[model samples]
Target: MSVTGGRVPDHHPAHHRARGRRGGLSPVPYVATTTRILRQLAGDHRSVAMIVVVPSAIIALMFFMFQDAPRRPGVPSPFDDACLIMLGVFPLVVMFLITSITMQRERASGTLERILTTPLRRLDLLAAYGTAFSIAAAAQATLACVVSFWLLGLDTAGSPALVFVIAIINAVLGVGLGLLCSAFARTEFQAVQFMPLVIVPQLLLCGIIVPRDVLPGWLQWISDVLPASYALEALREVGAHPEMTATAVRDVAVVVGFAVLAMGLAAATLRRRTP
Candidate 1:
């Protein structure tokens, strides 16, 4: 407030303080948002099923598909090799779908607008979303990895714990990317549509189906930049090495960098308008 004019100018300290209050973080709002999101997700049985059941089902299906395939003595089963990476990829895809659609629904239904009217800063809201979904992602990855390693006989030459950790990170990466992409979608259907555009290309180029070195020069360059490529590379490293190597560490770092970048972009793009 200005003493003389009865209006605070842009240069006024009071104006700056008020702005900081509106934009600053508050633990109360952050915890409330996280709990509210978790409660809502719990009530949505289909989303719960997607998070808990879908990834394991996919892994099971893949296991059966390769159950009887021939392999030379002392050789790793092709399924084991694929399953290591798929464990990460499956949760990632599922979390991406769930996160993007859920955010789109919130935007289209005016929930975001109501939330923004509160004391919740945009960054706090996004951080809460990240925390909530990352929990879901961790559960999703754990279940799938358990089913793969125990029930399906999926083998890894490396530490299974490391594989599990990477799987969770991959799922978190999906959540971040999903949040970023949801900002551009006005409808759930459009959010779904982004999966093919954003995820499918990375799938084809992520060195799962073909060796990345065998890919064309352009494709190799493209793969080098996709987060999924780094994720797969890390998983393959865990599958082939009994211990974590520098390459795996580097790849995981790259994936984490991309995830953080996506979260930052998502926060920047958040809006109070109902879509």
Candidate 2:
């Protein structure tokens, strides 16, 4: 008996071919989903401006207005410490802006629910956003470094590698903190409201304006816990005194520890918010 054209014989190759095609197409959806998230992040003007303007302005002010001040006998001069502190502060500012803007916009437009309808994993979404923000932060940090060096006549003692490494770490840490704040914030306004909480405390406690050693004993302990303190210490050690090989390595480790800790907390917070 002849089978009809529409009827497939047992073990037909077409069936298997269709299965393979579907398997291949499965990843396309996920890739597109990730790209969508990244595009959204890139298109946000407030975040873009923040990543560009804040760090650039801070570095410019540090280099031009104060580079000539005399170094105290024992302390690193304000010029030496200014860039280091800026590295720490700039990232925090960038993180706050990006996280606050993105999350708030999503909440306002009620698009977050639509995004959650896809098969895209939560961690993947977080990773894509973090990667985009990190790129912007890295670009800002680099521009700040180049402008500070060229116009302010600031010197890194030819240790360009160290400067790049420091800038990347700062950017990563900033993204992490921003993510954490976004996760906790109920709205964009709430996220922006956290700036004074994150930024002001760091300014007062991070050993920038007031040396950590000079603080009262209890206040010194508080400064020690601040992530910016470690970063400022690391930057000052590397940028100001490139000749101190052993000290630079130790300080870098301290900064890395803070970055890792902030990232870990942010990841945990994201995981909780994902479901």
- Residue-by-residue lDDT tens digits, candidate 2, 1-275: 13576677656886654454442224544466557766776686765676777677877776666856777796756765667567656776677667666755665576656665554445555566566666777788778777766666666553755766777776777666677677777767787788888767877887767888998999988887776777666666676665656766776677667766765676576533322
Note the residue pairs that clash in candidate 1: none
- The most accurate candidate by lDDT is 1
Tens-digit lDDT track for model 1 on 1-275? 55775776798876765686674577898999999999999999999998999778988988888889999888889799778878878867888899999998998988999998876888899889989998888888778878988888888889778988898888888989899899998789999999999999999999888989999999999999999999998998898899899999999999999999999999999876544
- Superposed by TM-score, candidate 1 places the C-alpha of residue 191 at a distance from the truth, in angstroms, of 0.8
Taking all chains together, the TM-score of candidate 1 against the true structure is 0.92
- How many clashing residue pairs appear in each of the predictions shown? 0, 0
Badly placed stretches (over 4 Å) of model 1 are: 1-24
How many Å off is the CA of 68 in candidate 1? 1.0
